[model samples]
Structure formats: C-alpha cells, structure tokens
Target: MELLLGQSETQVEYDRAGTIIKGQEVILPKRKHEDVHVNNHTSVWGLWWKDHQWAYKCCQQTIRNTYCTGSAGIEAAEAALDFIMKTY
Candidate 1:
C-alpha cells in the first residue's frame, strides 16, 4: 500500500463538529513459523501465527497549529478471523 501525506481528496461527512481523519496505508510482511511436535523434546519453542506484521508511519497536520499522530501500516484484517476462532 502507498502512504499519502495530505488531506483526502474526498471529504468525509460528520454529524459532529469534530474532524474526520484517515489513517495512512501500510504494507506488512507475511511471516510463518514451523510447527513443533508435542512428543518431540528437541523443540524448544512452538509455532505461532501473527495477526499482522509490525510497521509504522508518522503524520503531522496543521490546523490552528501543527499537530502529530502516529499510525500503523498493517490493516485490521485479523480482527474478524480472531473473533470467529475465539482466540485471545
């Protein structure tokens, strides 16, 4: 995904006076771990799946004054999957 550092071309409508903001786009790397057998004593660790890779970007805006906020690139894609699986 590409990161855009300016106001969105399309304005968002809001019911309240507060501004509607958009987060930056980020591309997270995909990772996979090897599985371990319960009977095998040689394996020190077990395989695990990560919801999303870690990536971050910073943004700044000037309204009455300049303000800053941090954003993560990875999408909230794992939320639904985790909820369905009942995983913490």
Candidate 2:
C-alpha cells in the first residue's frame, strides 16, 4: 500500500458528508530522494492526519521517537526529511 498521501498539483477531494475519503486527504505527499533541492528531500516515510491530529511514520528513516501533534508533526517531518536526505 502507498503510505503517503497528497500531491502538489492535485486538490484534495472530500466525500458528500464533508469528510475526507480515506487516503484522499493530504498530510505529506510521497517524495523522492534528491540532493539538489531542499523541497524534494522527503523519502518514502510520511506524515499523516489521524484521530483529528497529525502523526508521522518512518520507514527507511525515523522522524520522531514519540507521537507528534498539530504543527509539531509538520516541523518534525520537515527536519527529519532534511536530515534523511542529507545523511542517508
């Protein structure tokens, strides 16, 4: 299964009930390993929205040791992604 959601070019879609239909919601989109640009730093690991809060998942690299919520999730993910891109 695809662990990541969202795309930079695509608009997120919701259901008739006003809820995001499963994996359609954008948390952090899947990104490839690239050394040239900072924006393209993320790898297969991703952040997601769960239980009305933000959570992160690590695959080849770890982003956080514990749970992250709200803006912290985004911040942690960005830092981790940059680190992974540089170090891994």
Candidate 3:
C-alpha cells in the first residue's frame, strides 16, 4: 500500500490568524505514552481542520467551504486556514 500510495505524505498545521502554528517541524508520538506530550507541543494537536485540498467542516455542514493547495506546503495551508477563518 505504501508503494502504491507513496510513503511520503504532506502534513501541515496553522493557527486561526493564518499564522504558522506548526509546519514540517511537527513531531508525532510513536507510542500512546508520548501522545500527550507530543499533542500539547504540536499545532495540529487538537484542532478542527482535519483534511487538505478541501475546506474544514464546522459543526454546521451548510457552510462547508472549499480550499486549494498552495505552492509551499506550510505557507499554503496557513493561507487556506486564514481565508476560511475570515470568510467563514
């Protein structure tokens, strides 16, 4: 599956103000024990934004917005998130 889909992935995180909360510097906990520490220190730790190439869905579905990937991975994500916050 990794071969077919490609092992490399693009993960990003940003703040509500469209500022960089975290980027490729993101570090994930390898085990459950590390989950707490890592999450607290990470930007994407506990946020609503889940998917990319799409708008983040709030509790209300009627307002589901749309987004596009940016040229730079982190910069693009921040811009998208910022737009969403402003528009929505």
Candidate 4:
C-alpha cells in the first residue's frame, strides 16, 4: 500500500508486512528543512519495530533508493514508528 504525508508531498510505500518499501523523493530544500545535511557522502537511515525494520541508504542523487532489512524478537517499535512519521 501507499501512504502520503499530509500536504508534504512525501509518499511512502509499504508491503503487506507494513514495512516501508519506498519513501518519497528527497530534494535539497526538504533535506535542509529536515536537517539532513550531507555533502559528498551517503547517509544510511533505518527504522525498526518489534521484529521489523527498514533502512534507506540515500545520497544527493537518489533518495527513493533504499535497502530493507528485518529484525527478530526485538521490541523498540515506537522508535521505528516515530522515525517513519517524522522523517517523511
């Protein structure tokens, strides 16, 4: 399924397991607003919940491109939820 952030033009794609498969395209303005300042470097960010996690390795040219991974027997679900909510 696809989820769109309220009026932010950010879109997130999830699989049947509720893991984020894709996030919206990142632009310079939005990146700056989010305080993600990366120059000539790649940033890797991930989200995790009880037994679930997703990560995105982003660069200046590609933000939608992500790498996903999963965890097991873990409980920090709230952190993953918050990361997803605020990042998008």
Candidate with the greatest lDDT versus the true structure: 2
When sorted by TM-score, best at the front, the candidate numbers are: 2, 3, 4, 1
Please, what are the lDDT tens digits per residue for candidate 1 over residues 27-87? 5855434332222222213221233422112221112112223222123334455787896
Kindly report which residue stretches of model 3 are placed more than 4 angstroms away from their true locations once superposed.
1-71
- Put down candidate 2 lDDT per residue, 24-66, tens digits, no spaces: 6557846544222232223222454445543343222234334
Q: Write one digit per residue (lDDT tens) for candidate 3, span 1-65.
A: 76978755666677888776666674786767424322112222233344343222222111222
- Across 31-73, the per-residue lDDT of candidate 4 in tens digits comes to 4433552342234444222234443333212223333222321
Error of 1 at 80 (Å): 45
Candidate 1 residue-wise lDDT at 59: 23
Global CA lDDT of candidate 2, please? 0.48
Sliding window of 10 residues with minimal summed lDDT for model 2 = 35-44
Clashing pairs in 2: none
User: Which 10-residue window of candidate 3 scores lowest in summed lDDT?
Assistant: 54-63
Candidate 4 lDDT score at position 56: 38
Model 2: per-residue Cα lDDT at residue 83:
95
The lDDT per prediction is 0.33, 0.48, 0.43, 0.44
Colliding pairs, model 1: none
Which residue pairs does candidate 3 place in steric collision? Answer: none
- Better by lDDT, candidate 2 or 1: 2
Point to the candidate with the largest TM-score: 2
